[model samples]
Target: MNQLRYSLFVLLGACSYGLHSSLVKLTTNAGYQAEQATGAQYFFGLLLLLVVVLFTKRVKLNMKQIGSLLGLGILLSLTGVFYATSIEQLSASMAIVLLFQFTWIGIVIESIYLRTFPSNLKLISIVFLWGGTLLAGGLVSGHMDWMSETKGLVFGFLAAVTFALFIFFSGKAGKGVPTIQRSLIITAGGFLTVLLFVPPTFIVDGTLTGGLWKYGLLVGLFGVVLPVILFAIGTPHIDSGTATIVGAAELPAAILSAMLILGEQITPEQATGVLLILIGIVVPQWRSKKATHPKKVYMN
Candidate 1:
């Protein structure tokens, strides 16, 4: 029951991420630039995190540790930025499917870092993952126009790549810091990263008052603040491989959001793709037959 509760937290965190692309699309439709929404997301998210952090007791860290956390924050921010840009060209559901590539990408990262090949189980998972990706991406339903959507494809893939890196490092960075405090610092770094590409004029350009703050608040709450907080509570208790499977909730949440919020259609093929992807994520994590020495087969 305790493990189930922690898994729920991680599940909710991933579901929160699924809301972001749809929100970004809505904000874009309201005449806000995608980049502006990214900025506002981090801006408002950082402010909320700071509020929570202020009431908590403080712990000090040296510059090196701070830098490491900040770097991780930058990677987190890039995932959002790239996903937003990808949604600019693709349907919200499709963009999210691309971002879900993070699953297999993470395994690859683990393999390289561990200096060992992924076990046959994970290799099989990659095949299922790509097969589902192709179907879910609308390639088989004949709606596949991304042959012309090069930039969107690239950005979407980048979102996956960066998110995978973030997941990889999150285990190692800020190991002993309080969760909220670490999240606050990371959000601060993310806010600064967004500012680098998008000017901070929203601070004064009447945009916040001009109704931009509403979108910012929404995006910030769901996209950054809640997910980070929940993951901080949840991820530590779950193993990496299981967490990856639990994170698969994000895709279904995204598809639902795109359908209900963005009013995007989910074709039969895409639905099948989602199923396969989930299968890919779940099946690999099962203890393999040679499980006497589990490290020999990393489902992670």
Candidate 2:
């Protein structure tokens, strides 16, 4: 039951992450640029997390711990930039398909780091996840163009790599720190990363007073604050490979969010893909349960 609870936390976090694209589209429609959207997200995300940390229990950490968490946050910021830029150069479907590569990449990285191979069950789940990604991303329906520029492909895959790293490391970094404080520091790191690349003109410009702050607050709440706190609470309890597979929840959630928020239509193929992704998530958890409680044999 505890493990199930941890998995639920991670699942909810991934679903919160899936809310990001739709929010970005809505913000864009309101005349906000992509960079500004990202900048506001991290900025307000850091602020909200800071407030949460002050109200929660806090802890002290060494320089190494702080540095590691900041590095993890940098990976987070990098993934957003790369994934968003990829969508600009390629079809949204294609960019998503490429970004979804994080699932396998994460598993491989975990295996390499731990000097162990993935279980056969996990490998099978990977197969199902890849198939679902293709379908859910619209590749199977011929909605994607294969002729995207090399930069877009590179950016998409880079996004995948950084995101995979973040999933793998978030569990391991600052292991003793309080979850909210850990999240706050990570958000601060990410906000700093955004500042390096973005002007933060949203701060002094009429952008915030002009109503971009509304989008910023919403984006920070869903995209940054909730996910980080949930992942901080959940990831340490789950293995990196399984954690990556579980995070595939975001793909289906993203599709559903688009349908409801943007009034986009979902096709039969996409629905089936979402179903398969759910099955893939179930596959490992089911195996975990069986492993924990094997059937007893009756001697005749």
Candidate 3:
């Protein structure tokens, strides 16, 4: 039951994350720069979580906890910067497929930490994931925009790496901290990290006045606030393998949002690829009936 609850929490987190790109695309199309959107995202997200923290009781944090949350916050900022740039440079669908590379990357990280190779199932899933990626990326459709594609791939892969690190360390660190408290501290760290990337003039200038808060609220809630809190609450309860596997839920959600909301075209091939990837994701969690029970024999 606890497992089911946590899984649900993870799925909710994925759904929130999936919607992120679509909303970001909307904000960017509305004439917001990536830096502006990103800066606003973390800034507003910090404020929102700060409010939540104030409402809740406070817990004392030691230096170790402070350092861990701050480091994770830095990675979170990298994920946002790289990912939002990828979305701006490429179609949202393609950017999402590339970012989903975190699937295999997470498996590799897990193997390194545990000093073991990936299971046959995980390796197989990786094959399917990449296969889906090729189709979902519109490369097979001969729609390659190399100028944008090159930049997108670079940033998208960076997003994947940073995001995988965020998941790995977030799960392992700050286990003793309260979920909301941890979320707030990490968001504060993210806010500070983001401030470093954008120029001082950008934040201090009048740019924040023009309907920025509306988009900021969306990205802050879905992109930063909910996912951070949900993952923090749930990831610690499961192994990183399962946590990353469940994180793939963001893939289909992103693709569908791009197609439906952004009006990006998805071919039949890409649809099939999405199905295959879903199969790969589910295979790891499947428990075989035969493995669960065995027949008993009695001899006279």
- Using TM-score as the measure, the top candidate is 2
Q: What are the per-residue Cα lDDT tens digits for candidate 3 across 1-300?
A: 455467567767887888887888888899988778788888788889888888886678899989899889999898878987887788865777778889889888999999999878777767877777677655676676656568888999999999888888878888889888899889888988888787635456777776888998898998889999999988887667667777877777777888888998867887877787777666655433244455888999
Ranking by TM-score: 2, 3, 1
Per-residue lDDT over 218-286 for candidate 1, one digit per residue giving the tens place of the 0 to 100 score: 999998898887776776665554565567667767777999998989888889988887787666545
TM-score of structure candidate 2? 0.96
**Would you list the C-alpha lDDT of every candidate in the order shown?**
0.79, 0.90, 0.80
Runs in model 1 deviating more than 4 A are: 1-7, 86-98, 143-153, 237-242, 288-300
Cα RMSD for candidates in order: 5.1, 1.7, 3.3
Q: Pick the winner on lDDT between candidates 1 and 3.
A: 3
Model 1 CA lDDT for position 178: 91
Query: What is the per-residue lDDT of model 2 for residues 1-300, given as tens digits with 9 covering 90 to 100?
Result: 567678889899999999887898899999989888999899889988877777899877999999999988899999998998898999888999999999999999999999999988899899999999988887886955466498999999999999999999988999989999899888888889889889988899899889989999999898999999999999999888888999999999999999999999999999989988988887878877776687899998
